[model samples]
Target chain A: MIRQANAVDFWRGLALVMIFVNHIPGNYYGRFTHASYSISDSADLFVFLAGWALRHLVGTPERQPPTWYLVLRLGGRAVTLYAAQIMITMIALAMLASVAILRDNPLLLEWHNAAAVFHDPIPTHVGLAAITHQLGYFDILPLYVVLMVMAPGIAIVDRFAPNLLLPLSLLIYGITLAVPISIPTWPVDGQWFFNPLAWQLVFVLGFVMARPTGIGGVVRQHIVPIRIVALPILIGFVFVMRYGWWPDPTWFPQPRLFFLFDKTFVTPPRVIQFLALVAVISVAYPTIQRYGPRLVDFLSMLGRNSLYVFCVGSVLSLAGQILRYLYRGDIVIDTVVVIFGIAMMAVTAWLPEWRERVKGRPAPKLAPSS
Target chain B: MPAPFSRDCQVGSTATASESPLPNVAAALRDKRKLKILAIGASPSAGRRSARGGHTGETKDILQQAIRGLDVEMINRGVSGELAAQAAIRIRNEVALHEPELVLWQVGTNDALIYVPLGELEQTIVETLRWLKERKVDVVLVGLQYVDRMAQDDHYRLVRELIRKIAAQENVIAVRRYEAQRLLAQAADSGGGLVPDEFQRSETGYVCLSQYLARAITLGVFGGNLRPRELQNLPPRPQN
Candidate 1:
């Protein structure tokens, strides 16, 4: 069956790749792919795409599963991803420890201890700390799990009680702003490693967009015009931000405009930027669907198995960081190492599909029978 | 010192005879030739005062005035409570704008206080010096010498060594303020220091050494009248 790839899937897949590319330091293509243009906007885009993709894959109002079943499925996925992340983090820590031991540098050893990753003569250090003092910085699994658990309730409200979901989400978002909450950072009381209060807005937004009837469908229809206007506006804004055309005040502690849409908390600037990105991508949907056959297929593979891909990609990047520190020579070698790392991630993503083909397991149908 | 002053006095007297007495006297006494010397330091250089009275006396100004007939214009740009890192950030925009002939860098106290890693501090200093040198500007590094309490600390030793290393590598003048302060402290103990009373009253006070060192640095850079008594104790230099 020749299936039309979902527009949200394409965008979300593209965003995930961008996130990976941006995470890698000094990656040449990072400028184009990274949300560094405006981090808040980039985050919004990721959240919006996530919402769209979830709706597209999980089923809309017309073909909705029971609330309890939906909850179970999402919760299970979240738990699986969390376990996988923990394993990946352990592997990364092990590699870092090996590097430190080999170097004979106490400074490197100190870094591991400071980060709470060092465990020698007893491996229980990582496990013991994982229970009490979670590795917040390197771990997004907990936040993702919380979002997933909340998704079913959001979905139910969207499907059965549309008006209530919109206003309730908006109200919650407003309350969040008024009484800002933060998830505490490890090793520090106030420091939030993942500031859930700020991040929840993104998840809630995704839940709302999962319904097929509202803005998502409207956006998907007018994708072309949105793209034409959005691409130029984004470009112009970047130019103004970079150059002194619209100068940030030197006297001010933080830029006035940046304050409005700061990523430190999910602010209004991010909301606009995300909407703009969505509009532009919606317009380009037809073209992306038509021309980039091979690229789309490869990216779709990444999108379909995002959790596995992300875990593997993170481990590979960590290894690359260790290698770069060890070699400390030519830029060319570093570039080659990064490329190898990316290739490894791509292969790992493709592995499951290859396995499915060998077992003769059919690809899951997009629109399940009612 | 006697010849230069006497020659200038005689010239003033001769000029008053020929020209209108009022205008000629005004011109001779104007002494308005501003010496453009930039004194850049952290808190200590900003804090020094005269031992005698209420008027705060910066050592840079005194040394500049001592060499007044040389037409020296001195600008004191010492900011209080700044480490080497912060100084580096502001240097390109603020400090270098004066187009100073000699930059008297007196910092590193705050760096020690904040416990800035030796490597990072060294990098900041090296980068700062390179930036100045690239513009063909001369730099005279003032070594960080705190009181007896802090002098024995490892951080102070690191800063001292780093300063010496940077000075030698960059081929810049290294003012050994630490050693100079040590000598002054010793002199105060022997009742022969510059501000003996201040030293005697507050044994750990920076008043005497900072003033003397600042004056010595200013004079050394600007060719002033006040002799650097600290430099006299050292071995004689090979005459070029």
Candidate 2:
């Protein structure tokens, strides 16, 4: 089993809390979230950590798990995410419906892309299950489902040809940007909010790096130099974004697809920025764990049960939105919502750990170790 | 809920509604029973609920019901903090993708808040209006939402006048939301405060704005001083 309270859990748990606050469209706390200052926000953290967690959850390349069992395990996680997404969507629609009916205002039905669910449920439910249609602020899980489903393949590649995985993933990502392709949404007709094709690169990087050998190993060996390069990029992006000054797109020559800062493609700047952040943070995580506040343990507990916590956080944030709308967003309202939401998430995390504790099982991990 | 109509604050409420700015929208409605309307820009049209609970969708639903026997499909792509300059560039792609018959843009608030370059904001609006005209897409400019305190804010007043000037120069129907909202405050009980409480969106205010917008559309489409039928059965806010 994995270490119960570590930096991975700490960071992931923090990301969940941030994601919850950020999901609320106009919450007062939004300005304080990482998105305000950084190009890549908690979403990047969540995805990257998911990749990092995959290594710990499953086996590394040296002692790979049985192929069939590994496939089944990854498949199960995917199915769970798929179901969680569908459930949250249905519940969010129900929440919107209750508000609309209770207030006698049909307009709430149209907000947040919930119109499809209300106007036509059967086909839209199909779209929701198929992961083709997603509501605003309720997207990332589908990407999680996709990444988990693809994890076995990544693990397999990491086992057989570790070098091929990143190259292949990058090749696909690069091709998508050059071709301007993405997974499309349904009923509404737009691209998926979190395009998986490009995002899988980060996921693969997380998986490969967690291995003792590979790009991650290289980085661990030369982290000082990597941090030296990364530190400047982070400071530069922070300055540029803070000043509302972005590099002009026209300055790039032809085939500038790779250079653009567009979010959909997970372009160079965002990826590089994220990588730089990771390089610096990874170097400092051990020291942080040694001298961190008591809050770190509290957050790590939430991180240990991330899936359940994330699902609960998503629904709570929606409720927070409704509460914000009804009561009006003041400092008090926002603070109360965030505290209550985090508490709810913490409770959700505790229940699972408590359940497994009473049962005397080794804290029900994601997959059974062979 | 037949709220008293405010003739004084109604900007384009007169007959003709300024040469039927959304001709193609009406034409499309008449020809095929379908019309696509794109709602863009900030706060109001983005279908956001204010502290008072006013919804942009109230306007869409009211227009559909008032026009009677027509399907109005609305695509709301409202990013709350989007500057007019950013929206101007983005709208080109939105138009290319959706090809909406009419575009209802609610802007100025974010620009006012951000203190964007006044000349840049104006140029963007002028260029966007010209582009829409060339594309034969009708547009209605939903100006800055009114907050009583905003009247004293220099940038807010300038943006409001700039929007008014743009609407006149381009000959488009500018829904004077601020004026109507101020009228709403005036029409409310005096103890309720003479402002629309900018923090919360009011359902009554949403209804009022929707009704006014529907009336403006009806006037534009049929060139008559008509109003949406009284939707009498609406629920009031429960006492907290």
Candidate 3:
């Protein structure tokens, strides 16, 4: 029997599309992306799903992986993410440099914080390799890399003292927000676009929620009540965000990150909104999968091969921005960009499965929770 | 005397004169013996593309030369091809992080290129300027660069007009880079092509921009209550 497309992959795939649209700043489609009406955009969903995947990687009580194996696997994955970030950042710089030289527009050289690479290549290059300096629109992976490097720690805590896992994550999240602590950029005095310290809360939430025991089990048991409570928040925030109804920043007390709806530090409001969103989607996705099987399959494929599609999407988004600039981002140009760029991402997602088929090996199965 | 960095640098006088007090910048210079400026713009506002560190180095040197024992720390956060909305966001983040007292916001060119809706652009500029004002941060709105094609575009002209209006309304200093470049380009045109058409792409263009900025900043900090002509004709510091 053919397996149905799962919600995890489907939502992850949709998040990828949202990210693609939002990444291309000034694209006409940007007006309709998830961020327009939601306090938290696809970035939060993306990170949360990544943490969900870590649940499988860490394994369950019945078939837990050895601590050493988990460390090596997560470490290797971190290396891959690091390599991808470095390669893409270099490619992005090269793309900007080529366009700048060819079009006789040096301004292209400076887009998305690439000016540092051109102006101060040596230090910036070091910063790039070290993940201390990240190009705009290309920053999420550095956060992923850090989170992946911390995955072993996460697994150890879950394995040994599972009770303390979430409280510890929340404690870190609280400290990050209250102190307004973030990883600072090097070779440039700035903070990371996504603060991993704060983001790890969402990741840990995903991890814990994926489990059938503990708070995850509790949430799963009371999901209907949770959905009821979450529904108003979801509906309420849509209007709140749309109308700009949040309290004024001036009104926020000191250590404002705790109160403000900040993306970088993953503030409380955003987290609350995102969790409410997830709750609502949990119920809605089944109906979606039943009614829109093809759409579900398509998005599931994108989600299954998220890393590959995301890498392709990042480059494509940059290309889309350049194209929009060159041709002007009217609705027509934006439509073409969105359609073509997403198609390329789909192709990227398909190639690995095609390779597996060609090698006479079955495509790897998603983890049980996934 | 012609500006040392660029020969076609007679545009310094055209920088919008501001009676608006740059209180923080003035105070920083007085007490700390240091000045920190964050230059956030599109292209040459970062520095010259052809000449590495050209505009930034030139601006620093001019500022330091003008005020002995004054340390000028400059931050170049110029992302070429950025629109007003995007730049405004970064400006907030950078200001919050770096706490720069003055922001040199070179805007309008890229927004004009993309034909960003006039009201949207105006709102972003007005909102950001007000936010900066709330923080007591001084802003110098460097207007669009002169491009021949954009000169005829009505939307482009409107965007330029909007920048001027916003600058005046916000009481921030404005650098008339477009007017200066257009005048220089026109003069060069009349003189049979002495200056490059794309002033923003050339070494001279960025050098001229740096000189204009350096002069405007120096005058803003020091030449308070001076008339525009006096600010323009202010005597150069004696060479050591």
Please write out the lDDT profile of model 2 over residues A91-119, one tens digit for every residue.
98899889867765444554565655555
Cα lDDT for residue B164, model 2? Answer: 86
Go through the candidates in order and give each one's DockQ. 0.02, 0.07, 0.24
Per-residue lDDT tens digits for candidate 3, residues B48-131, read 332234466677777777667879887766655567887886687567655788898989887876678899999999999998
Give per-residue CA lDDT, model 3, range A1-64, as digits (tens).
Answer: 2234688889999999999999887788888887888989999999999999899888889999
* Residue B139 of model 3, lDDT score: 86
Clashing pairs in 3: none
Q: Which candidate number would show the highest lDDT if scored against the true structure?
A: 3
Per model, the share of native interface contacts recovered reads: 0.00, 0.00, 0.14
Alpha carbon deviation, residue A361, candidate 1 (Å): 8.1
Clashes of each: 11, 12, 0
lDDT by residue (A202-277, candidate 1, tens digit) is: 7666756555467556655676777776777666656644552432222223223223434435655556556565
Which regions in candidate 3 have their CA more than 4 angstroms from the true location? Answer: A1-4, A361-370, B1-19, B23-82, B87-101, B131-137, B145-157, B178-214, B223-240
CA displacement after TM-score superposition, residue A39 of candidate 2 (Å): 0.5
Estimate candidate 3's RMSD in Å. Answer: 6.7
Ranking by DockQ: 3, 2, 1
The share of true interface contacts that also appear in candidate 3 amounts to 0.14
